[model samples]
Target: MTAPLLGHMMDVPLLVSSLIAHAARHHGNTEIVSRRIEGDLHRYTYRDCETRAKQLAQALIALGVEPGERVGTLAWNGYRHMEAYFGVTGFGAVCHTINPRLFPEQIAWIVNHADDRYVLFDLTFAPLVDALAPQCPNVRGWIALCDESCLPAMKTPVLAYETLLAAQDGDYAWPLLDERSASNLCYTSGTTGNPKGALYTHRSSVLHAYAASLPDSIGLSARDAILPVVPMFHVNAWGIPHAAPLNGTKLVLPGKDLDGKSLYELMESEGVTCSAGVPTVWLGLLTYMRDAGVKFSTLQRTVIGGSACPPAMLRTYEDTYGVQVIHAWGMTEMSPLGTLAKLNWEQSQRPPDARRALLEKQGRVIFGVDMKIVGDDGRELPWDGVAFGDLHVRGPWVIDRYFRQAGGTPLIDGWFPTGDVATIDADGFLHITDRSKDVIKSGGEWISSIELENIAVSHPAIAEAACIACAHPRWTERPLIVAVKKPGAEVTREALLAYFDGKVVKWWQPDDVVFVDELPHTATGKLQKLKLRDQFRDHVLPTAAAASEQCPMEPLDANIDAHAGGGAHPVKSAATPD
Candidate 1:
């Protein structure tokens, strides 16, 4: 065998700190704007951000933070949290971003599991910090991401962020470290047991940032102002914090105000050209725009992910407001960027409906990622687009294993099982049909819950919808549509059941429609079907009965706000008779 040839090139590591330093050196004037917890917009340039980030690194060192130690943050998307993105990782420490939306117990468990030494939290989460301080004994200090005056009086001793920065002069250099050293940590929303962590290395994060900034991905550029309506605690705000700085694009952080009105105001005020978030957040923004009869002036595009974006939402954004919707899909495991639904030149020239139909799929993988589908027999499926199977992906950014090696090996034959049921067309576009566990098996055939839910939400009266499996006598399990209606909009179960006609095969149509006052969602805005399945585990489908009366409709909450935050959507109730 011939000896491996080595390329003669510079051996510089791809550190997260280098991204911010590059931005400061080249695009020092680019703004990092934040709607603060203190109830005002705070703005700074990349230069200022870099300097403070250095000071933060110095502060951490002064406070006895050691190399490779985990520093946890329970803050919103803001200037300080952005600094921590560079500072903590830059200082050779791991930046552990804890989702504040998780239960206090879960947060404490994560803190302990990560063995975080210092915890920094936004002022909005001060009370939460106080509650968690006693629980997280390993967290030596609790620092508020706020000024001294703005800091709330907590039972635990909390340090002020400004004070810590003021104590240090920006005189630190990012250390040279191995590219594969762990730099960031994020836990998956442990739906089954305890949440497991996805630890990211400097090399993977930097590579992810580069790929995510590509034209086919988020298409970031210097001229654009980007607002990450996605929480920073959630998959690094879908990698916008890094990509924005990498591209010298203006970063607009909407702190805590994820509701429709607040986000719309923030985007307009900042002249945001591009934004990224889940479907529920966009639902809020669209609701606000429709109610106010207003259109976005500067907003040109949006990246929707964290859940399957309904086609109706995409059409409304593009046709009504001239905003192009970039459908995206990823998980906490893959540095959270696997596929983006960008149309190729040929596909772009297609008719509006045809183009949208293509975009409704999860989209194609960017460079650095490889994906394939496998059937139950473990054989790879063909790319004919109709043959659905388990989606598996392997790439430089995807996790080889979980942090602490919690769940054993998640890969199968070198491919990471994405827990998604998908199909890849010959053109290489990936279409996510349903989650592996969420797919309903009626009789011997498989049914896509996502397809049914998408069709349900397409109905004007439906606000949000979830399709779950219901126990059956013959079929073993049948499709059930548990939906929420828009305020004051009345749609009977018969009408909804009939609405599915012609759109899908007769057997694939949901056997019953059960409306609820609200639907549960995960912290990242994904529909929580597990909870719904449990809630309706004993539900008796009307079809099974010989004769049944019409199901009683629950009264709609007159002032129900669909755009409300907190991982739950308000919905109206109406069920098919048993």
Candidate 2:
């Protein structure tokens, strides 16, 4: 065997600290704006942020935080939280971002699982922290992400963030560490059982940022002011924190105010040109804008992910508001950026309908990621855009294993099997059909719950919709639409079912429409289908008798309570679309 030739390039490690240092040196004057928890906008520069981050590292070191120790945070997206992103990771400790929206017990379980040495929180989460203090025995202490005067009352003694930083001089230099060292720890939104952690290394994080900032991905640049409506705790805000600094782009962190009016005000006031978040947040913003009769001034584009974006929502943003909607798809395991739906020149020049159809897909993979669809027999499927199968992906940024090796190896033959069932066109565009667990199998045919839900919400009268599997005597399980009506809108179940006649195949139409006051959602803004399935497991359809002539079933089950000719509670007037 011949020995490999060595390159003459320098071998500098790619640490998180280097990103902040580079930003401070080159883009020192760029602004990092944040709507703080104190109901006021806070502004700073990259240079200031870098200095405080260094001071924070010094403070953590003074508190005996050792290398590779886990540091937890339960706060909104703001300046202090941003500092912790670089400080803890830069100083060789792991930054574990805890989602505050999770149940207190779940949060405690996650904190204990990570064995967090210190938990920092905003004043808004003071009560939550107090509630979780006794449960999380592994947490050493709690630090409030506020000044001394603004500290909130809590059962346990809390350290003041500003006070801790004030004691340390901002002269500490960032330490160089191995690029493969773990830098960030983010847990999946444990919908099934206990949450599993995805530990990210400095190398993976840096590579993900570079790929995500490319022209075909998030497309970040210095001229754009990017607001990550996606929370910092969610896959590191889909890696925007690192990408923004790397690209010298102005960063705007929306604190806790994710409402439409607040987001509009922030974007207009900050001159934000690009933003990113889940479909639910954008739906709220679009609804608010339509009602207020306003338009966007500086916002040009947005990246919607975390769920399957509805076609109508994408149309509204582009046709009505002039904002380009870039549909994205990924999971917590893939550094959450597998594919972005950016059109090539050839696809972009197609007719409006054709272009929109292509945009509706999840788009193509970026450079580093490789994806393919496989069948149940473990054979790879053809990329014919029609034959859908289990989607599998593997890349540099993808996780080799979970934090604690939870379910043994999560990869099959070197590829991580994403829980999604999808199709890949010849051009490499990935179109997600449904989640493996959420896809409905009726009479041996696969029906996409996501497609059904999208069609249900496309109706003007429907606000939010969820399609879940209901037990059927004839077909093992059938699709049932559980929807919430828009405020002041009147639509009957018959009319709503009729609206889907031409949109989808006749057999794919839901067996029944059940109006609910609201639908449940997971902490990360995903539809909680598991809960819905449990709630209506035995719901009987009106066509049960006709579908199965031999067996006759009652129209309503014992658990079902009638409300305005539909199952479950009566529809509430004020319910809004997700």
lDDT of 1 by residue, 1-578 (tens): 99999999998999898899999999999999998888889999999999999999999999999989999999988999999999899989999998766567877999999999999998878888878988889888999888888878779998998999999999888888899999999887653356778889999999999998999999999999999877788788878899988999999999888888899888888899999876656766776787788889999999877655556567778888999999787777888888888889999898978887789777899999999999999999999999988889999988889899645888899999866677899878887655555655443234567778889999999999998876443343568899999999999999999999878667779999999999999999998876887788667676633111211111112111111111110000000000
lDDT of 2 by residue, 492-540 (tens): 9999999998676677788899999998998999887767776875577
Which run of 10 residues does model 1 get worst, by summed lDDT? 569-578
Each candidate structure's TM-score, on Cα atoms with residue i matched to residue i, is: 0.78, 0.79
Candidate 1, which segments miss by more than 4 Å at Cα? Answer: 438-578
lDDT of 2 at 346: 89
Error of 2 at 546 (Å): 30
